[model samples]
Target chain A: MKQWYRDTGLQARMFLTMFLLAAVYLAFISFLATTGVGTMGIVVVAGIFIFIQYFYSDKLVLWSMGGKIVSESEEPELHTIISRLCQIADLPKPRIAVVENNVPNAFATGRSKKNAVVAVTTGLMHQLNHGELEAVIAHELSHVKNRDMLVITIASFISTIAFFLARNLMFFGMMGRGRRDSGGIMAVWIVSILVWLVSFLLIRALSRYREFSADRGSAAITGQPAQLASALMKISGTMKRVPTDDLRKVEGMNAFFIIPAVSGSSLMKLFSTHPQIEQRIAKLEEMQQKMEF
Target chain B: MGFLDAFLGKTKLPKSKTKDIFAISTANVTFEVNLNLRALNKAGICFKPQASSHFTQARAEVEELLAYSCKDTNTGYQITKDAYGYTWIVLEDPDFEDLVSNIYLVSEGLIERDFGEQLLCALFTFKEKGGANVYWIYNFKHGNFYPFAPKANKERNSAFEFRLRSVMEKELPIEKDVERWYPLWDVPV
Candidate 1:
């Protein structure tokens, strides 16, 4: 019996979410096997593409965000803090990157622990205090520890194939990507479209759950749940005044962000890549009260 | 966590490990004789506060015990709230052995009370021949000791600290990383 506790039920929730996604992928594959050989070919091609993406995701995402990996000499304070947090998290020291923007956001990107890169915006550094910054870094390191990217990438593999098939079929006028129109072409197109839509939602939901798990992980690593919760609130509050134009620019990478750029209360709540700030903060505050006393 | 780590059920092993601080008492002889440093006869234990009653009770008990135990040792202890919100149990005694024993008692009491993880670092203040300050900081989290000799704001006496570390390496488990020699700036003596 341990004296302290935080919410790791989020881990089980992520697993269940992935399990549901795996089931959906299994059904899609079973349906595809009945359709034709073209579907299997698409699967093979998607696997290769996913493998490439996984290997170079850290570089690709950093490039896309105009982020650069910094050396220890250049950002010794950042490196020192991250290494200390990693020591607590029991993880390898991941590369630290910095993005020269004012959006007040931070993210972790990589396919595995060894290949992880944690990037933060300049605004975040200017905006948060030491404890807040440390808490945010702990959150990013938690994501690396969780390997949420790898889990989602594996989940997305089959969905990407289905998406490739569906999009190409739509472009090729209901034909199977320059292949002979088998009688089951109509069925494959419908199944592909359904799989694409459903998998997209499932991945988003899993992503949200993983965010919760990472929040919990950060609290555990730092042993200061309130610090993380306050940091989230600070970031989210700062995010609102960061100019909607700037927010929209990187909104595409919302899934990888500490706090998404979305404003208050959107219609896309169900499709949100991250949980609501209020919900996350409430959970953390509850954890703080329960675990501290 | 990796799939293998999860499969092996290795989730969340204890993050912090605490080592015996009595080593410092033995190492004091080497530091004084070899490095020409003498204990200022002042030591302090730092810990982060928790809101738990158990922690509060343990802190109260430790303070009471320290007060009672030091009544005849010509030693005095002070409780200070540092600027960083970390609480310090500062002890002073002309006899270095009494200071070390007092710190050991407070630390052991906290450990027995299940609040050991909250213990941050134990500081044994020492002085050079010319009255320069050097600290042997025992990191409770990492279970290692380090020498911190801070000169003005954020500036470190790196050369001297490194030499002290090299001299004391065999006597104590010196923290290998220079970055982790977290300087206790403006620590209330």
Candidate 2:
């Protein structure tokens, strides 16, 4: 089990992805500094906003999905299964919730271990069997155990700031021109756009790697890799059958889905939030073989 | 505690039989004092299934021993399977001491027969607070005992559980690790 954590190549990929994101952020900062558009006030404001989001992310995500916390009575089977898995994994039981959406998906979110919440869509409950559901819950628990939410939040903080700066660059640039140099303002605008583009790609890469790592972690916890592999296949197949209008509504939240909701176009794969389902299943099969030996 | 310690890479030792036996005594007292509920004169043995023919024969022998040993004491025995497929052998006696002794006899018989790995848990039931159901669960996996106070709505009453734990800590060999106190959630009456 320990080897599972140590051997996760996805972890290395995530680290590299974050490193690249940091490089982009630093380059943007340098451009702002050289062009005299680097304002202490703006940095302080962005930092505060990031900090708030970091702390409130779990609650925010759940609220956005219209999720409700379900006690043991409301979801006895789910509660029992989650508690049993927590027993085997030897971790504190996280809060369990259910979202009323028709989309079959689940995600774990929290600022810390104790405060974590795992929410599954109603569609997921209808779609998966007991074993497959256990696989999904175990996968989410892996994310909680690994502190993935904190890592992702920190890594994405800069990208969020770059997005904000880029969007409001015209106003900020005018302010900077009066206080400092117009040339510096232009450099800051240009740099912020570059930062937004590069960080966007890097964050997506990091998100994909984390999904793979979480999948491996789930397999180890349940000692059944095939369960999750099958669950992924089922979810991906169902995702394709959903109407395009409904899919478009949730396109922004695609990263939180169990299977990345995509039309299976090769072009779409280049910017997808998760690795291809076949690739993920192949990795799980590899792990299953390793476990047998 | 054993389960948590194992996960955290602590010492590995077989669960103490003494601790498993002792958890029942206080709940037995609580039944009489607080709720006017009689000790249903019963104890249960829970185990997993084994595929080997030898193990099957051994289980049959243990059941036979339990049947013969408790007949004279007016105690009854029954075996049932839970939803999760765990097998349970229940023995009943009005005398708490006889009930414990009978459980010990059955457990020892299984251990001697080399079916120890199948002994997953032992459960002692009690009725307190005017026939409210409560249980003391001894997990063989952890070799520890924890209180389980089930509410009417199927949720655990932590306050009642805490009170039971505090009052009976000395009488029962309580499990100290919080993680090992797994709630059985549902138990057959």
Candidate 3:
């Protein structure tokens, strides 16, 4: 049997981070319950926020990037490769999308695999060969298989609530008065800030691990890690040649892009959705080497 | 998705699996008894070729040795590369049992030569009421058999394939993962 390489260390750290995040959320909920901000109010508001993100963020992301869903006839080759990858991944075929841009990159985002979408830019089709393109598609499909979108959404929920709490306490003042009056607000503020700070790094670290795991998933589905490595090289190599004007076109949605590109969301945020190109390529190469044994 | 499994990103559900492809040979009787499917007595092993000189030499040796061993029998083999770059070593013989043995011998030769990882899959074709091709692919990596019957360009006869699996499931170690049933379009068998 094909024995896939697993990064137990990375997996353990990810689990620990999630465990700690859960703990922090538990304490935050308890704080909310006692501090008398009407936990119901916060829950309703958070629920609405998450509900919108869960259901509609995909459309918003697609629209913002100027992507349109293509029929199978228009891109049969793409559909064929994706269908094969799905079978190998045991994933239901997700909706396929194509953005009319010159960027040689792709990403997968949706609430789940059944309703998921894998979009590749026009340039990516031109840039990669069949094997390389298959690798990218496999990577995106792996994200769907691993449910990275949902994990990131949940992680986003935790941070959004923390940010919301901290901001409300800072600007609009505390809701219900607790036993300690001003002291309760201060305590909530400290907790929110701590959660926010920790989650910023923690979430970014998780994002990086998700990228690595997705790379591994791609290897598993395609059975060719080197194809992904070469695809990364070709994309990154051409990423430099694609011109700044074109890069700025998709800059608004760079956070969700596969490469975690330039000109948006501070070049060095402690958190990013995609891993570095060098590191991703290296990971795929390592996977390729390990699969030999 | 338990709280911990979801946290650890265990959402990628593992599909069904198998390892002993010899089960395919053993399971052929069920196909004939139940589904009216007959072995075509033509089988092939599809593999991605390594770029090494040793691999090239080993492939040539396999071809030569098979030709020598089956000189008296009608066993014949040919190596053809598909458009997608995978090499198919096709074997043919009227005796169904001989085809399986010949396939096994060639596969073992490749594995003994340390080209095991390069071996992708072995396939044995089956026929329904008429002369329509139904291929059962044995994945070398997973060591399981899955049915693949491509209709047109990349379209699969999945409904019929599921029926084929039902017939063979009891006797063969069928691949549980529906995802692993990769189609070999326009296969020359």
Candidate 4:
């Protein structure tokens, strides 16, 4: 399992993906900065928003999911498992909360691990056995340990701002341009739209890679990659039969879903928030076999 | 902190000398003030390896020793297996000192019988941080003691674990090998 962490090939790929994302972000920001489209002002406002969200993301996510922060008294077994996993992962225990929803899912949220929160639905508690539950929780803890929340949050922030700029360029251009230099304003809008589209795809690709990283993290922490692989299989199976009505209401929260809400479409694989479960399971199996050696 | 750290061979040896159980007694006060945990008067013996004829005789002999030695201590003992197949001999008493003494005596007896290899851990139970549930985990393999401070919703207060380590290091032979701190998880009661 530890060997997986030291895999230079995997690390090189991860670093390369990160480098590409950085390049894209820098190019977008430079374009906006050079064009004098109030990008600096937008960047300042977005920075403040991201800062606030980063600090309060765990609490906000828990609240948004209708989760209640539980004390050790409220859930001894759950606390025990998380604490043990945290010890193995060499992380401080993140805050634990439980969502009232009956969908079997779990997620980790926070800007950093110290402030992270690991929340699981009541349905998940009823679905998995102790070992399997530990595997799932360990997986979420892996996300926390790898600082995936911070990466994903930052990635999404740039894309989100790009999206806002693209959609509201005409409004901003009108406010700043006053019917003069219409060609310049048109070019600005086109640039913003292009930035938005490109950043959106890059953000999703980065997200997918982070998921793979978290899977590896989970396998390492738990020392039982097979348990997590099985858990993922079970989760994906349960996800399919889950009532879409309840899930649809929470569709906007798909970015934080444990198994991203699956929409039945051939195109879903291309746009889904998470990698296909089969691929994730296969990766875990590969690591499991490596550990056996 | 790296993957290599996880694969290193675990070193096991018989505890060189039996420490007086009086050390664990001090934790009652330390736990309350520092960790906000109440000592649950439940000390459990954890042994690894599946049950076999030799193990059964060793366990019985250890139990006999404890019953005879603790007759005046008023510590009640019971041997049971948790869901994970780890064997535990639980000793309950209102007096924390008596509980500690009983645990030490039993551990010493098992070691004397050459069954020390099967002795995995001895756990001193504590209530969860915000509630009245208990967690007692003793690592016999490491010969070092640590606390399992569970939170209300099933999380551990690792900061508290570190604090406990700092405070209790001088008082007990704490496990120096970090890997040996394998958590004794999911013990009933």
Q: Pick by DockQ: which candidate is best?
A: 3
Model 2 pairs in collision? A35-A184, B41-B93
* lDDT-superior candidate, 1 or 4: 1
- In candidate 3, residue B76 scores what lDDT? 80
Q: Report how far residue A23 has shifted in candidate 4, in Å.
A: 0.8
Q: Which of the CAPRI classes, incorrect, acceptable, medium or high, describes model 1?
A: incorrect
Error of 3 at B174 (Å): 7.1
TM-score of candidate 2 to 2 decimals: 0.68
- Which of candidates 1 and 3 reaches a greater TM-score? 1
Residues A1-293, model 2: lDDT tens digits: 12432343555566677677778778767666665465656667888998988789788999999889998778988887787666545557888999998878999998877899999999999998877888899889877776777777777787777777777766876765675566666666677777877787787777777677778777755656778987997887843544466777888987765654445787666578889888888888776665544
CAPRI level of candidate 3: incorrect
Candidate 4, B50: how far from true, in Å?
16
- Alpha carbon lDDT of residue A236, candidate 3? 74
By lDDT rank, best first, the candidates go 1, 3, 2, 4
Native interface contact recovery, model 2: 0.05
Q: Taking the tens digit of each residue's C-alpha lDDT, what string does model 1 give over B1-189?
A: 457433211234243455557788899999889988989989998876655555577789988888888896778989998755568999999998898788778777777776665576789998988868889988776778899888875578989988987788888988786756666677776
Cα error of candidate 1 at position A154, Å: 3.7
Native contacts, share recovered per candidate: 0.03, 0.05, 0.13, 0.00
Give the range where candidate 4 chain A is weakest over 10 consecutive residues by summed lDDT: A1-10
In model 2, what lDDT does residue B10 have?
23
lDDT of 1 at B183: 61
What's the i-RMS for candidate 1 in angstroms?
Answer: 4.6
Q: After superposition, how far is residue A64 of candidate 3 from its true place, in Å?
A: 4.7
How well is each residue in A1-293 modelled by candidate 4, as lDDT tens digits? 22443445555565676677678778877776677455555656767888888889887888789988887678867876786556434567778999987788999998876788999999888877766687789778877766777667766777777766667767776887688766766776787677777766666666776677677766655546777777887776853544466777878976765655555675666566788887888888887666544
RMSD (Cα, Å) for all candidates, in order, is: 8.1, 9.3, 7.7, 11.5
Clashes of 2: 2
